[model samples]
Each structure stands twice: as C-alpha cells, then as structure tokens.
Target: NEQISKYAVQDPELEGMGTTCVVVMLKEKEVFFAHAGDSRLYLLRNGKLAPLTKDHSRVQEMIEKGEITPQEVLSHPERSLITRALGMENVLEPEIGQSFEAGNGDKLLLCSDGLYNMLSNSILEQILTENAAAQDKAIRLVQRAKDAGGYDNISVQVIEFQFKEQKIILPTTPLNFFEKNIDESSENISPTIPKVVKEKKIVDEEKVPKSEVKNTFQPKPEMSEKTPPAVKTGKKVPDIALIVLLVLFGVVLTLFFLGSGMTKDPKPSELNISQTPDTNAVAEPMNEEPLDNQQETTAITTPKKDEKPVTKPEKPKKIPKDTLISYTVQAGDNLRKIAQRFNMKTETLKKLNRLDDNEIKTDQKLKIKVRTVHTVAAGDVLSRIADQYKTNRELIKKANDMTDNATKRGTKLIIPLAKAE
Candidate 1:
C-alpha cells in the first residue's frame, strides 16, 4: 500500500486507480495461483464446484466462520466495500496457493467480485458442463452478471482442460555446454507423458494420439536452445592417446643418449692404404735410354710400405648417473633459499621448470642435480660406501681409483649418485 500510494501521488494516470491481480500458471497436471483483493478462483471437477481462492473482503471472512448467513451477505449494505486493494496506504499480505492436479473435465474459473456477486455455483456449473468453450463461456458469464444489473465493470476467464488437448511438459534443468553434451551421449531418452486439456484447438489436433499407445514416437524438441543440445562424451579418449604417444617419444630420446659412447670406434675403411691414395705425389719422367727403358722396367716404387694402424683408446663405458641432492621442505623455504641451499643459481631452478620467474610454493618438490664428491672416513670402507649408496662395491672402487677395492681414510672420491628410490 505504501508503494501504491506513492505511485498514485507521483503518477498522473494512476492517480486514483487500483486493481486486484490474479495469475495462474499451468504446468503439466498442476496449477499454481497468486491473487490479491476480492477476485476469486473456482474449480469445477466432476460435478462439484469448489472455491480455490479466498476473497480478501471482511464480509466473506465473517460468512466463512458462520458469523453471517449467505443470504445476509448477498444483500448486505457493506458488501461492496473492499478492505484491500493496490492503492491502499498499507497493503495486507497476499495469498499464494499450492498446485493441484486438474482432472480431464475440470473447469477453472477466475473472475472479479463484480461477476461473482451476482451469480452462484449452480449458474456457473451448468454453463461449464454444457461443453461451452472457455472464451465463449467467459463472455456469457460476464454478460449474465451485467444482465442482472452489475453496478461495476465485470471480468471473467474460464479455462477448461479437455483430454484431447492434453500436453505434459517434463521438468527440465539448465545445463552448461559440457553437461548437455554428456547427457545426449547416453542411450536412454526419457519420454514425455501426455497432458490433459479440455478445449482442443484445431492446430493441436496432431498432438492427440500421444495419449494412446498407437503413436508412442512423438517428435521431441531439440536439446539446443533451438533445442537443448545433447552432450558429447567421445572426445576424451583421443586426448589420452596423444599423451601416451608424447611419453613414448620422450623415452626414445632418453634411450638415444644411452648409446652415445658405443659409436666412438673408427671404421676399418679409414685405415686402408690403397683406398687412401696420396694426391700430392708428382711423377717425373725417368732419364733413361730407350733400349734400357725397354730392357727392364725396373721401376723402383720407393718405400711403398704398410703403415701400422694406430688405435685410439676408448673412454670407459660407465653409465652416467646424475647425482641426487634433495632438500627437505622447511618453513620459510622460498625459491631463493632452496637455490642457495644447493649453491645453485636461482635462474637454473626457474629454467628447469620453464617458469618465467623464480616462484616456488611451500611443500613443492625441487630437484637439485650436482657433482657428488665425498671423503672417506674411518668407518667407511668400499663395501660400506657401496651399501650406503645402494650400489655394488666395484663401482665405488672404480670411482675412487682404488685398484684393490681398498681405500685409505680421508681419500676423496667422485661418486656418481642418484636419488633414492
């Protein structure tokens, strides 16, 4: 009422005007209603007419509690007074009603108090049950009230639900792109049940046979906005296969480095003397008589001797195991602290991770690879060192240059190490 009164004072067109508004939304078998003022909603199911909406007038309440007889209300001098309306200074609470299933022959009638004040249920039910169409019946009901001397303007809306015009709209939830795609990839498509309607429009004749089992296959609206779209579930597997291929390629590249030392030996064709002719040697004509040249061609090939093959020593074939140094995550361990702990450059950590800047969060793993050099102590033998490293004793001896697998105390060794498994 505060809002309406403010609007009435502010707006010229709505100055003294007020209204009773009622809205009915029908979905599937249920009907929901919202109403204000003395407007009424009535339902005629089977042969009985029932009032589904309450009139907000004071006299109606008195009559409902049996304080006043129906005859007295029909002729009461204060019956026309409306205690609640849109333009009041203070608006009272409105009534919102729950939905109920409407039967095949149900008649829903909505009307202003001007129409209901002059007519009763007997007059309403006869017009509804006579197979009168809703728009036609609404006009007749309004005229009947006006014919009985309506002092006020009358309005009525009659809605009839016939079995032939039935349509059931299934409940639907909003979906994003991916979810909609996933739902469509499923095999089951839930069918929509047929709804019951009273007056069937000629355009809706094609929708009739769905109630019967004869035409079970009715065309449904597409899932896109044009129809709601179906979800696509088949795209993920190809992505997984591409990831596996990339991993396999990485393994092949790492293995290629493992065979680098094996190709160091020179080929035998490079050592052959005949295949490697001396291009710089110039041949001069021999100063000899023609008869002597013909007598014996004692052509002295000077020092055409076989040169010995010089074999280069191959490097020791020890698989390079990277040294493993790990720092336990601690409080206040930033990327700078972690880099400084291993005496590594901060840029190296960022480069290893392909990060633009040195940004490391707490508890994140950082691998530090460096040269492993350690000195032997009194308690440390080759066997013990090998055990500590989880490696064989021979490897420790080879690393330290101890021929007999014996190491003196305080002897430094270059140990090729790895992270513990």
Candidate 2:
C-alpha cells in the first residue's frame, strides 16, 4: 500500500486507481497467503470445500453485525464496495492468513470477486472437485463466470498437490569360499578344487582304519615327465613370438625416423641454393626468368589513353515499416519495465496503451508498436545497417539498447523508423 500510494502521489491521474490483491505462495506442503478486498482463496480436500479467506467489504461487515444474512450478499448493492484495497490509503492493513498444511490429492483455488459473484459457492466446489487437470478447471471456472454475467474481469488459478513415491532395492547375499568352490566344481571337478583341500582329505583318509576308509575319493592318473616338457614348450612359444614382434617394430621405427631425416635434410639445402646465387649456377637462371616475364605482362595489359570507364547505377533498398502487436501486462510489470523490454520509450508505451499516467494492472492487454527487426549477419555493422535503412546510427543503437558498436551475428535488433506520413 505504501508503494502504491507513492506512485499515486507522483501521478495525480492515478489518485483513485486501485485494485484488490491476493497473493498465495506454495512451499513444499504448506500454503501461505495474504489479501485485501473481496478476492478469495478456497481449499478442496476429500470432496469438501472450505474458504481460506474472508472478504473485507461493506457487505461482510453488515453480515458480521447481524444486519444481513449470507444469502442476501448476492443481491446486496453494497457487496462490491470494498472497505480495504491497495493504493486507497498511504498506510493500509491487509489480512495475512496463517500457513496451512497441504496434502496429496488436495486442490486450492484463488480467484477475484468477478468469479464468485457470477458463480455460487456450490458451483465452485463442484468445479474444484472435478476429475480434470488444473488448467482445465481454471478455464471452466472462468468460462462459467463469463457465461453467467461477467460484468467485471474474471481471473482464477487452480493448483493440485501430488507427491511421488520412491523405491528402495536391497542387495543379495554373497557365497562362502567352500560353497563357491563346490558350486564351480559341480560343472568341472579337477581344475576347481584347491590343492590344500585335496591334501587334507587324503591325510584324513590315511588316519581312518583300513576297513572304514571305503575309497570314497578317487585320484586322477599322474602326468608323465614328457608332458611337463611339452607344457613348458607351449609357454615358451608366445615368448619367442613376442621377441620377434619387438625386433620387427624396432626396425619399422628406425626406418620411419631415417625417412623423416632424409626429407628434412633437403629443405635446408634447397633454401641455401635459392638464397646464395653463387652457390648454384642452375638456380640463378630459374630466379631471373620470372622477373623478365613479369615486365612483359605489365607492358601488354596497360589501358589505352582514349578508353572510357563504365559505371553501373546502384539500386534502392526497401525500408521495412513498423508493425503493431498486442502485449498482455504480467505480474510485477510497470510501464517503464515493459517499454525497456521492447526497446521503446515509456511515453511511447503509454501512448500505445492510451493511458494518461503510468498505471497498469496484471492481465491488462495493451497495444505495442513494434519496430522493424533486423538480424545481424556476417560483416553487418551498426553504421552500415543505418545507412541501408536511411536512419541515424545512434538511433539504431538506442532502439536496440546497445551499449557498444559491437554486434554479433544472428542477433535480432529493433530498427526505429520515422512515423509514416
């Protein structure tokens, strides 16, 4: 209210211009809100609708005083007369509601008086509890209000709470050493069992009596000495092959280095032959030949004294005209801010909006006179673009809000043009 009053004092045309405000903030599972005037907030939980705010209007005061009932508010002529509103006083008090916990599947509705005045509470509750998206519910509510008798501007917002569930996964148990060995040996026995286990089993069997031993374990036939030598030969084959590969690789590297050295050695010799005329007799004649050929070419291509030079006429460029577009005022927007966004002056924006002062409200639609947009291309400078459009370079810079002459390729710039006669 203080901010609005300051603005109103600066512009006398905005002295009586004020609006009702309702602000709601949702953080995690909590809702916080504050409001003035007849704008309201509602909550729908488990198919039950409840009001979260009360209107600060004359009708509300009368109802509190027991002079009028709730049903009589719809037909009351003083229902629209708000006792509290923004910009109405220098020092004002707004009703700040307490924070409330929200739950999953809960729906919240925030709207202006235009909506509730046109539609009843029962209709609003039905719309809030509908099985539809939030955007759809808001649209339906506004459309219903407009259909009924939307003498005032209708605004509505719907929010639904939905929490997601997370899943947790547990790891499996690991196998023991003996169990792992047994499981692996089920497929193949000899290679899987450890040598220590085999030795322990044999020693245990020896301690048992001869009659009780029962030959439970069987031993495989022993490998001959020739088989060991063949195994050593198999392992040594890869070593011999690796040694041969190393020798071949070393030879290739040596050849590569030698070839590079040979290529480099001739470059210095060629440069020396060209630089020193007395060093090579053949190089001196080759260098002098191009000089004589250049003199002959220059003598042949000289222009005649009587020949006239021809020039072509330059073509004119087509200047782009300015266009008009519709822009909607958003929350926290002012005339200066909106004008700066489109690279325009505040006075020009006010003229387009047909406003005597810099007062604007949320969701207000205004006309914007957009200038010609030029996309910067390779080799495009501010001066060149200005010359092409027959305008001043400084004007172009100001229209595009440029701080310096530097313009990057593909950057769209607004070109301010003179008003068409």
In Å, residue 405's CA in model 2 sits off its true spot by 74
lDDT of 2 at 241: 56
Per-residue lDDT of 1-421 in model 2, one digit per residue for the tens? 5566678558744534567777666554566666766777777777766677777665666666566676566554334456566765434456666777676567788888777656666677788876666777788788787666454667787877654332212223232322556765667533222222111111111121111111122222232442221112121226775665566445334433433343211211111000000100111222232321334344345557897655578876566555443454555678888676565778978875678998776545565554455555546677887787676667666544466677654344555554421
Model 2 misplaced stretches (Cα beyond 4 Å): 165-421
lDDT of 2: 0.54
TM-score of 1: 0.37
Candidate 1 local Cα displacement, residue 408, angstroms: 99
Across 1-421, the per-residue lDDT of candidate 1 in tens digits comes to: 4466677558643443457655566654466665666777777777666677666554564565455565565444334434345553232334556667665667788888666656666777777676545666777777677566554456777777654333433223232322456666654432221122112121211221111111112222122444223344332337765665566445333333432332211221111000001112122223433321335456544444585555689874333334433232334567776554444567776665455766554323345543443444445556766665456665444433345755543334444333222
lDDT of every model, 2 decimals:
0.48, 0.54
